[model samples]
Target chain A: MLKDGRVFVIPCSGIGKALGTVGRAAMYEVVEKLRPNEATTICLPLLTIGDEAVLKLARNNPCISVDGCPFQCARKNIEASKGKLVASFMVTDVLRENKDLKPKAVTELDPKGLKLASILAEKLATQIDEINNNNR
Target chain B: MAIVKDKVGVVSCSGEDLPEGTISRIATRIVLEKLRPNDTVTICLPLFLAGSEDERAFARVFPTIAIDGCDKRCAEVGTKKYSGKPVATIVVSEIMQKYPYLKAKSRGKLSAKEKELALKVAEEIAAKVDEVLERKKRGDSN
Candidate 1:
């Protein structure tokens, strides 16, 4: 099992657009900064390829997928890998909610992009806390 | 160097099926995180393949280096298909051929040999970045 009863985070390994980077930045914030003890991450591509250890972890732990677009590659891969997805987030939804934050540059996010990532991270953190509380 | 305005885009086939794929990802990270942090930016392969106009647009504007793990050349082919042809391409399998002693034990974790291979590939990528930047500078000057 994962240490500290943390949730697994799967970010869409979508490198194509600013939204994809936003999803990845938000996932990093949730896993490495905001909820370091409460969340971990599995590479989405590895899960797709059926990595045994990642599959086992997914089967055992609840996961949250952060997808860049509507396709929800992270969510689909998690389901395909036999992992339980407790909650999911979409960068497009976040952008829709926060219309002011128009991120520029797919590879290098501008300041607005970082702000958007933080906002999404905070939302994800709340969802993770809710899952933990319910489990407890 | 007169403050190059654009950074090189680094796209790797972060394929999970093979150890070479893992090597490609690790090596890309080395370039992004350690080697040429300011000179290169990573473009996600999945999004690029899945029709992200933003990624395709960025590749068209910036010089891109596609790093492939295997002979399938998914990264190279995908970049060329969606965006323009990459400025340079690096295949991990070709790198492996050059350094047969370095081997990756698993797709999930990098063995010592794999780490070495990743470092070697990263250095090569860094060199490529310099070469691309040099070409760009020359083109701009001309």
Candidate 2:
């Protein structure tokens, strides 16, 4: 049961490019489409932890860390900030669900990744809704 | 006198966000500011952990930057985890701590001051990167 309605969708900034076609697609579908009005999607090169805008949002809302890989930088960053993370997702987790995606190594940005991202986004949205409902 | 090779990496750890006045980005921008277009840099992040090959190629080509939002160093640690040697590390807390009002109103976005801070941090990083490059050149000369 969570009281906060915010979703923090963070992807490990640069590495996501490797998701190539699939990764790009996922970014557009999930981040562009499902990122809640109350939420924001942040992307930066591996360096530059959020400047001020990121801190403001993180300090107030429940966080959702999305990593393109297992390192889970997005999730780890939140935890390090001493903020509570309400949810989490990984790009690999999405890839796991769609075994047939066969992601390429070069990371050109693909629609398959977008489709997977959409699916993952939908899953997270549902989870958030459930949590929000439970809190009520 | 310096025993450790001055390695630097830029990162943005703004917890679930694209850090605007991000020191890491600013630092990167500064470092690359003078670099020729043929000179490429490798941007490493925790997200690319699975892309081992890509990571290697990136590191092999350019210096690394690690930008951390909070104290966690998500970007820094990720770079190290993948064996990408980061010469410099920047934390967002350091910036926000110095300027508490940046968080005022809790809009969850970067303020103007924050951007200024990020660029400053970026410049600092650029300086460090130049220092390391010089050292590497010296080492090569020797």
Candidate 3:
């Protein structure tokens, strides 16, 4: 079962960008572990531009956004471009699940965070897989 | 008159308390070690925003290099906001892009090669600092 045929890992590249560290980890989960057919990471610039090529590529497909924090810049960028977002995964939620993971420590990508990201990616991928399968 | 010492500062978004990537930690340490007797070095992390009057302590330094993890530019922008001069900004992605060989197994872990490249970027930053200081001195003499 596939939920959506296309998936986009979009993060805000603003001055407060947190997704690169966290959301990026999640993207790896979806691509490597979950094995999605189409998964691409788009920063603020792409969405901000709303290029015709990008817009057309996404016009027929549903999008799932992964944001690093609550700012929702990823979702906002999509809306600003008149695009629809099927779902969103906020990284803060993942961080909350793992209390042992400290935000203060700027450690390298820890296995715990990776595990958490993969868990979320799994859920998202499963949902997408189901949705796509049902539509067929 | 007291001799004015040139200052070098290392700033990262991952607060001073947290341990960052091997390149960040190791490269920063190397930069500190290379400092001359007349040079001062500051290692700051973004978590210092919670500290009272910490901004004042930061502005006193010069040639600040912000080592941001991603494009969010937290350390780079914060240094500018606090009135601290940012001589250079290094984003980890830019460094990784320079050395495609540093790509991690999965975006979650940095490969050993990536760490080495990070050290190289840090060295470049140090070289930039030296160039900036020398340029400043020349301007001062004019």
Candidate 4:
């Protein structure tokens, strides 16, 4: 069974910084666990490549972009695809709020990094619920 | 005066949807941070498409090694379209043939075998970076 509301969670997945992977990990938590049915993810590269199927997903669903850095690639790509953005987040801000937690790896996150992902996921989940409620 | 060495850009596929994508990112990170930190810099694929001039300019002026998770070669394709052609492109799926035992099963968490495979891939990227930089030293066109 699937949930009622729909939103796309797009992570920048930038390999330049550790935060990129953290942001991606957080998005995974949001779509795969927290709001499984309400949110999903698409390949940002595919959308950039002008894939028709992916373009339709962006056109129809509201998007929530999570970026690891100031580049905001996911958010930019979504806008370039003409996708709608309901809300956006920065993993750095999440990290800023949790001064105690520090993420150190870009490839595979450490324990603290994983915890950071969870914290960011929880925040995104709350935003997702509000968007879902508003849409309803 | 200190001699400034040319730097190489490593562009990895965003690979948001696949386990192999996870492997590709890990391998690229190993190369950038551990193996050739001084010689290489990361070029985010999303940044290329999202209109980051600095990344595109770097790829155009310098040699780039595109690492892709699958045959789609998203990183390589994007690099070529936005900037210049990358000097080399490595696809993780092709490398998987050598490590039949490694199963990259999760995006959030990688299996031990997958971690080993990532190391193998990183070694490959590291070697390529060395090769490209050496060529630059030899006055070859990227």
- Who wins the lDDT comparison? 4
- Which ranges of candidate 1 are over 4 A from the true structure? A1-4, B1-142
Local accuracy of candidate 4 as per-residue lDDT tens digits, A3-105: 2237888899988787888889998998889988888888888877777877888888888999988889999989999988889999889989998888886
Show model 2 residue runs off by greater than 4 Å: A1-5, A14-28, A42-53, A105-107, B1-142
Tens-digit lDDT string for candidate 1 (B6-104): 689888876644678768877887888789989998766655544457656757777889998888677777677767678889999898888888876
- CAPRI classification of candidate 3: incorrect
All DockQ scores: 0.11, 0.17, 0.05, 0.74
Per-residue alpha-carbon lDDT of model 3 for B1-142, expressed as tens digits?
A: 2223366566654321112332454455446555332454653332233234644356444556776655656567666665465777877667767777665233345466655665676676677567767766776421
Q: Point to the candidate with the largest DockQ.
A: 4
RMSD (CA, Å), each prediction: 9.3, 8.9, 8.9, 3.0
Please provide, for model 3 over A2-118, each residue's C-alpha lDDT reduced to its tens digit, 9 standing for 90 to 100: 323465555432222333355655665665567556554433333333446556545556666666655565666566566657777777776677766533313344566555656
Of models 1 and 3, which has the larger TM-score?
Answer: 1
Q: What is the lDDT of residue A47 in candidate 4?
A: 78
How many clashing residue pairs appear in each of the predictions shown?
Answer: 1, 50, 16, 0
Candidate 4: pairs in clash: none
The predicted structure with the larger TM-score, 2 or 4, is: 4
The TM-score obtained by chain A of candidate 4 when compared with the true chain A: 0.93
Candidate 3 regions with alpha-carbon error over 4 angstroms: A1-5, A12-20, A49-52, A55-60, A101-107, B1-108, B129-142
Interface RMSD of each: 6.1, 7.6, 10.6, 1.1
- Comparing 1 and 2 by TM-score, which wins? 1
TM-score of each: 0.58, 0.50, 0.54, 0.90
Query: What is the TM-score (0 to 1) of candidate 4?
Result: 0.90
